[model samples]
Target chain A: MSASDYESASKGASSDVATFDDEEKGLFGRFHHALHATPALVPLIVLMVAIGIFAIVLGERFFSPGTLTLILQQVQIVGILALAQSLIILTAGIDLSVGAMAVFSSVIMGQFTFRYGLPPAVAVAAGLAIGTGIGAISGWLVSKVKLPPFIVTLGMWQIVLAANYLYSQNETIRSQDIRDEAALLQFMGIRFELGGAIITMGVVTMVVMVIVLAYMLRSTAWGRHVYAVGDDPEAAELAGVNRHRTIMSVYMLAGFICGIAGWIMIGRFGSVSPSASTGVVGNIQSITAVVIGGISLFGGRGSIWGAFFGALIVGVFELGLRMAGANAQWTYLLIGALIIGAVAVDQWIRKVTA
Target chain B: MSTEPILKARNLVKRYGKVVALNRCDFDLYPGEVLAVIGDNGAGKSTLIKALSGAIQPDAGEIWLEGKPIQLPSPIEARRHGIETVYQTLAMSPALSIADNMFMGREIRKPGWRGKLLKQLDRKEMERLARDKLNDLGLMTIQNINQAVETLSGGQRQGVAVARAAAFGSKVIILDEPTAALGVKESRKVLDLIQDVRSRGIPIILISHNMPHVFEVADRIHVHRLGSRLCVIDPKSHNMSDAVAYMTGAKEPDQHLETA
Candidate 1:
């Protein structure tokens, strides 16, 4: 029961005698412990190193304010989607339909305003509500029906994709029409010029979202419950956590975030195409960002900021390659390698701590 | 000790397919005493404890707490009735910090506006109380309350679980094999903690196979066999071999007035 008694007792129990003196560890052991203790550190270092490499290679172009702002603009959509994905991953679940849901929601917004004659503002709200509604369906299937998250979200992706095509009649809302009739539809695309960089409302929105979610996860009771459920649902339930409600809320919140992402997608493109090819890659891109950000695919680990950094890493690679006049295919190759590297590091951390 | 039992179960029956885990079992717990439920493997000791702790519902039974009939359909309901169970698994999240694990489900929020509007947790307060509880249980080896539970040794993990139960257990604490996984010194520490808990006037029901441990701390040993309570013996009057004999069905229990 006492400290001295516990030390002696534990020593007699196992032949591998290890003490709790963390300061006495070797350099490598200390580094391993630090990596396991703070998951964000690895990703943060990677981000910094990437920036340094790009800056050195591209010189004035990469370090310029305009290029930096462009990188922020490019990552906004995936960054938002990654935030949504992070919430699901934290609950030990996945959302394969994040991209489809965002695209479908965007199509709904455009069609509702232009075809259904609803006000642009009302159409936007309805689009967001529909995204949340679809998420509720996934959440119900996951929590109530007890289906695997991957399967449920996979099915939802196809269904939502098909619905987007059928409902819009394969129509593409032109930017000219949107500008002539409902200019507010492209409101988030509006940018203000700072000292040398132009910052869009979409990028600002992404920043605000990351900050709010980070605070929520770090400083709230609900945040702790989310981590608890991810760590062990049975233990969380025994400790008085409502596992069903927690999981359901996480799904619903992710859906709502995806809806916001959809709105940003519209602003980013200045057009709504039912067949937006990017919709197919949205889920993968978001997941990639989350994984590379040092957030555990298994859940109950990593920081929301890490996911943001992960998205930026992708953006940096894309822009850095383009500016350096490298083949576009190289971006994909590097990103693929980075994803593997991140997961390997995650495994190493888990092994050391475990 | 109070003449009337604080908690009692009557004719508890639980069936798992063809296997009858508990066949009309009955049990009782007096106030301010450590009652050890000991038996052979698969002798329904765990099943009986599960039914009592609200982890599993009995097919047909009635459980009385403080002389009142209570329905324990879930662990949350059990806690509401001032009953807490520390399972053999310990039931603490391995990746979560000790303070976070301690306040997993029942986290305290910041006072006034911050709690109401922002829904912020009172981390400082929770950490302070967690340290105090660990110290009260004489488990001060934990240098940081924010360290994850996985970093702790088996004995330390057990200490955290017991501390959590002791901090919140208002009426009765039920421990299922609390020391089954621990070593000699760790087991001794746990026995000391059990005695410490009893001194606080909280009755304990400890289900363990270690007869020496049972005899060391149990005021009365409840011998379980074949899905039912065989008998309850005063540890002072009966020895370990007698308890083991009754548990293994080698010896028949003497006819005595039912304690309940």
Candidate 2:
């Protein structure tokens, strides 16, 4: 048969079935379809709604340039960590040790510079290296040993947390000592005024990191491989993707980003303490941002930009709640609701798309 | 027609624990011909193709391409030898665009510093080529090259998979039941595509249970029965009932007939 003949036959066959194009769909169906097509839309809309409500309630306090910038500043650490978590999650994997790794690396930087008397720059590099090394171990376990990412990272989190305490002897690097000895450690905290808004170097770093990663994931072959692996590893492998290598690279990259977050953490707090209490919540917080960002926990969908907006939403909620004199627990309650709502939206979208 | 077979497999044996999937099976393909492999369910049709396509390594076998013995320990290795297999699953990522799925593992990088340093993919080039390949195969129903595979119909997805194989398969293409999940019209489109591919002079191995499709497009049909080849019959010489009888062990091949 000729191609046109087959085409006509196919057309006839398809006409037998009831077809519902996007335009023919009702309001809810269209909305669900749109959500599936553009993952960042829901999160972006939620962010706008949150901003509008908080701006109305808090009035001047929420709308003030300083308060808005303060939200950005407060979100810098978790935002950066969320970027790391986002990469791992994009590959259908999770890294529960991101916060511990950052804290551990920060402790290494402080202790190396003060006790070991290493140069500040060298100490920072060492901290970054240690973060990547630990990440490589996690990747090896995940890709080579075939261990679940969740289990491997969970174990790594505890191990790194313990190591941080033992290696630092539960000591806190005094902010004064860091300022006097390693002034560069405070570089990320440096800020400049721009149009009535205060912008810190840490915020710039976070923005740049997100932009670069978003571009890479959208345009690069390596980024495509990451998505491919997450979408379906067996299909990816048959199509010639190195599944193990892709999985491993994602873990290592997440680790490297977490290491950068560690440097930013030092700048944000100005002190590195080997305390489990403060850093223990890091994993959950980053995960919360990712979940709210509309990045599918199942992977192969969503964007880094969505995760960024997700982090910003949390920042807005926290500041808005404080300014409105609401109880702190209310923030958690609202965030919990958002997480559940976002996942429900995700499921709905999947059903419609599928 | 070339006298030498483009691909030849000898004494292939594969066993899964207690069950033997392929028992010393031998197979061959000539250049510029459509060879169809047909069998009952679980008759080791897929297993034999897997061995040839390098998805599985036979316990004892030798595969020859262009008259030279070659070892294909992996699917990637098979591709290197210009043997591409369009798996039953289609093996294309549904979330990615058609162009991305076409060049999933073998992406074309841009030339110069942007490609090397930044690892930038030549996406426009890939999309253009993907469009050309689809059009060349008369699979141009898809207007957008950037549409995700998930949005396409089952036949279109299969078209993309076949197009990928045809685009890259320089010597041999193996398709495992390309029309199994497709509708009648879609199956016709695929059969036409197989004829188009054969006219291009690249040999094809089509595995199917559809007797009419196999008879319509195949130059020769290999009847697989009980993990071994019962006979290789030319469509002009044997009828469908004869082939079916041989496949079901109700008839035996003439002793004078060639085995491989």
The candidate maximizing DockQ is 2
Give the per-residue lDDT digits (tens) of candidate 2, residues B128-207: 99999999988868878998899899999999999999999999999999999998777877988898999999999999
> Model 2: how many Å of interface RMSD?
5.0
Candidate 2's DockQ = 0.54
Clashing residue pairs in candidate 2 are none
**Number of the predicted model whose TM-score against the real structure is largest:** 1
Candidate 1 Cα misplacement greater than 4 A, ranges: A1-29, B257-260
User: What digit string (tens of lDDT, one per residue) describes model 1 on residues B11-101?
Assistant: 9999999999998999999999999998899889988988887889999989999899999988888988989999998888888899998
All candidates' lDDT scores?
A: 0.89, 0.89
* Model 2, span A141-199: residue lDDT tens: 98899899899999999999999999999999988889998988778888899877999
